[model samples]
Target: MKQRLGAALAWLEDRTGLVGIVRTVMQHPVPPGATWWYVFGSATLLAFLVQVVTGVVLGSMYVPAPDDAYRSLEFITNDAPAGRLVRGMHAWTATAMIVLIGIHALQVFLFGSYKYPREVNWMTGVLLLAFTLAMAFTGQILRFDNNGVWSTIVLVKMTSYVPVIGDDLGRFFLAGDVVNASTLSHFFTFHVFVIPGLIFAIIGIHLYLVIRNGISEPPEAGRPVDPATYRAWYHDYLRREGVPFWPDAIWRDALFGVLLVVGLLVLAGVIGPPEVGAPPSPANLDTNPRPDWYFIWLFAALALLPPGIEFYFLILGSGLFFIGLFILPLLANRGERSWKMRPWAVGIVCVIVTGVGALTVYGLQAPWSPDFATQPLSAEVVGATTGPVANGAQLFHEKGCHYCHRIAGSGGQRGPDLTTIGDKLSENELIWRIANGGVNMPSFAGTLTQHELREIVAFLQSRRSAPAPAQNVPTVR
Candidate 1:
């Protein structure tokens, strides 16, 4: 039976030349000293495969309608056997793919692989990156949770800032001017099918370019890439000292790929997926919707930007980023490949990574998140017995002051802590700040009644480091 099967396979191979094609791909030449750094691209590809398989499994059970989507996901997460694991794998792998792709791109940039013959490869890779992010964004909306819907609302608002045809694009995104049944369906279609399809096609082209151009030789100190002579030189260099990609370079990639998949599985089993918050509720003013971790930096950027210039940052910043990436290969396509010779490149990378890291940390803390969890100021913390001081503490929470101001380590950090606020300001100063807001704070003059304002101010005056007699404040009648 084995002999017969082997003979049949040989016959099929002879007819189709599939074996020859596999052999050719396996034996493709790679430059000498191709080390663990080369494994990142393969790892990224492995992550993409994980995402595809897991996403398909998840899609089978996921409902795309706004009404049933959250419930269906809850069912999958709690009722279906192994469904949580599958969903976790998909979510984790999406993040892993984005991170791996970023590292791969950074590797390419640092090694100067985008120069000369590999320009198109880099361009395809950038597009793939964009498509991967698009998939992530659309996938977020499929969750049908408050965070997801709010993210879409934020996205639509941002889209509406585009210079030309902004309204049309925004309307198209929201599926008829608002997030409804059609909105969820639109995102579901793009997430599971359209963006992934584009990624698949672009991956094919990216691989074709990689094979045609050959992997860039590890950067040398002084061997600057000259477009005219580099190709012939690389060919000659490979002929002299190249190894078959299958056994020599592929072993590291295989080891890394296996470890990555295993790690993802372990993470899925341990951490599982992000919590699916309450179903979409546009009217929920308390919702502090945030994107998944990879986008937290951008979310932080939007949050921390000066209030009115959000559109400028959304448009001009994004425009400059893509423009810079597109023009990179054209600007310095033939130059020194060594990072040692490129201080400006190193500086740019440092700045971007540092900025993103800082922003992500801030986003995680989310100081701007409403302090709905803030407990009312206790009498002990307030050091007050009665009168306006006690009423003021109640007014403090009632007026949403706790949402922005921290008090005795209980409230938010958006505004200055009022734990020892009495040490910093007089009653008049407190009243002034409350009546006239500064920067991100909202003024309460139009919103608060005179008695209410006095009560709030009385509460602020009582927040002291030590117990003290309440000041004899005149009653605001």
Candidate 2:
């Protein structure tokens, strides 16, 4: 045992020291003309650093309980000074990381960087992508809003499409039938710990490969060199390609990184974190409970398909997608490197992203229903007079009916306003009109009693024709 330990110590001494290690790996050359493209991996890694730091800050303030989750988020967004800024940066920069990593992968693949000598890099990259997506999914669920629960329900149903283990997979996803605090707990663990750990491992391996292979296709590299025989570390290595990490590439990446950071800060400051919805309500019944804009397209697509298809569309479609992603790379010829040579492959990717973008945009602006605007206050016609109109007035504003419609310069402009409505009709005619709305308004007669209907008409009349009440107008000095 002592002899073996001594031998191992001797091997370690040979390669472990600072100078010896440096002198060792410089054996391989960097890509001859290293450009912005070469630094993609570095940028990706830097973005990861940002994510980890930002995530830690977020976890510190966020609560995990049912009652506290929404209120805590409200505090972070509305009360905390820079909380919104931090949240936006965390969210939007995650988007930037995905985009940067994807482009970096494309650049690597396009330049033949994935050749035999650098296959390790390819493997590590694929794993990193999987980790990145996993982190995204888990982080999204951590929001714990109406959309979050709905997204989880929809995704679990989709997961149930797994062939032999379908039911088991669904149960595992739900951790039971419902997404309670436990579901958030599951997501928090995977997002904050497990997935991040796996990603770090993959990223470390990827960096090792880059250093091991010397940035793949340095312009000077012609014939492949033996990996075991690579040499020339500290002395010639730094002397040749040792660009100081700070000023050399740091300026470019740091500039963009700062831009990303500042942009997120501005957005967060301006918009704040997304408004916390009414606490996780099972009956909120937001028909189009779409995820954030990033995943809106997927949700819209899922919604667009025939409801009859059930989960089959999700399963078969996703299965076919991964099948293509993994197997399609093999079709490339040995020497194919240029993007032009892979027209079909590139086209397919473009189409997928474009379709997703288009669908997301469409869903955001799509009309949910005809009766969607702020519903006018309902009142009853009683004693030949509209009932207490202000009661209906209070309900109108209380229900947020103004979001999609206008009323006496008070609401949104999407639907008609009631500024001059009383000029056109008498009380009885107005009642008839209210009962049968034109295009967007819903009939209140069914939903409101005669007294309630009268109150709403009085409210509308008060807005359109009545003199300005002394209480409403402030006197000027």
Candidate 3:
């Protein structure tokens, strides 16, 4: 039996040369010091494989039509066999892939691995990052829920901020002048087919480059890259101390990849998928749509940017950022590779990570959005139980004023807290502001009656701090 099996294997190898190819790849030499930092790239590839597997399962069950997409998702979550777990795995793995790819990019940048012959590798990585994010955005819209619908609209509107081709771009994304039946199908095609195809192609090229150029060695403080001599030096260096990739360096990548997969599975089983929101409804005025966590930083930035320069910042800023990423190796590919000698690189990474982290936290709180779920202030908190003050307090919530303005710490922080407005503004001033409105506040002139206006003003006027105790004065001798 052993002789027969060996003969069959030899026959296959002779016909295809498959054994030699595998042996060559597995026995490829890499820098001996290439440690756990090198594992992230392979780990990211593992995460992407998980995404592909789970996404295929989901795509098989999800309906691409707008009318049925939400219902299909509900069915998959509640009724299908192990559907929820698979869906959770898909979502969590997408998150993991983004995080891993980001870390891998940062590692390469910090190590100066993008220098010399590896410039194409970095450029391919940038394309993968862009495509990964594009996949995420398109996937969010496939939920077809209230938040998803509104998010699509918001994205379309933002696209409309571009100069000459803005409207055309918006129309193209929507598949028409407005989001309709075709919109879901368009995004579904992008999420499941188009973006994934692009990613797969780029990933193939990236891997080819890695094998062709060889992995970069761990940076030494005194070593600086010189393009003219880098290839020869790298080959000689590898010849001196390099180790086979399979049994030596590949073990760390394999171990980390397994752990990452197990962690994602545990998370998926424990947490399940994000809850599906209400079905899409244009009439749902109270909806406060937000992007998923990965995109919240950009959302916060757009919300916080000054109105005058927002358009320029959105268009020019994003374009320049991506352009800069592609041209980075060209700018300074021969610099000192060690972080110890590149303080500016460390500072740039620190600033970017800090800024994104802070923005994400702020976006989660979303102080700028109206709090539609805010309850009416209780009579005790309002300091009134009857008459115009009490009635006005009730009206405050009924009229949706509490949604944006905080009074007794029970409302949103979008507008100014009006807890002590009476102390700052006169009755006339309050009336004018409320009647005509200012800035983000809407006009209540036609909405409120004269009696209601007076009642609200009376309620505002009653909100004052307690008077301070009288102080004793010193007498002159």
Residue 238, candidate 2: Cα error in Å is 14
- Clashes per candidate, residues 3 or more apart or on different chains: 0, 25, 0
lDDT of 2 by residue, 162-243 (tens): 7889878877876765566677777778888899999988887887777765554442223333334333432355457655
The true-structure Cα RMSD of candidate 3 reads 11.1
- The lDDT of each candidate is 0.81, 0.62, 0.82
For residues 8-84, what per-residue lDDT tens digits would candidate 1 score against the true structure?
87998999998777888889898989868888998988999888888888889988987789888898888889999
Stretches > 4 Å off in candidate 3: 282-288, 368-477
Sorted on lDDT, best first, the list reads 3, 1, 2
Better of 1 and 2 by TM-score: 1
Runs of candidate 2 with Cα error greater than 4 angstroms are 1-29, 218-255, 282-288, 327-333, 369-477
| Cα error of candidate 3 at position 202, Å | 0.8
The Cα error of candidate 1 at residue 388, in Å, is 32
Candidate 2 structure, TM-score to reference? 0.64
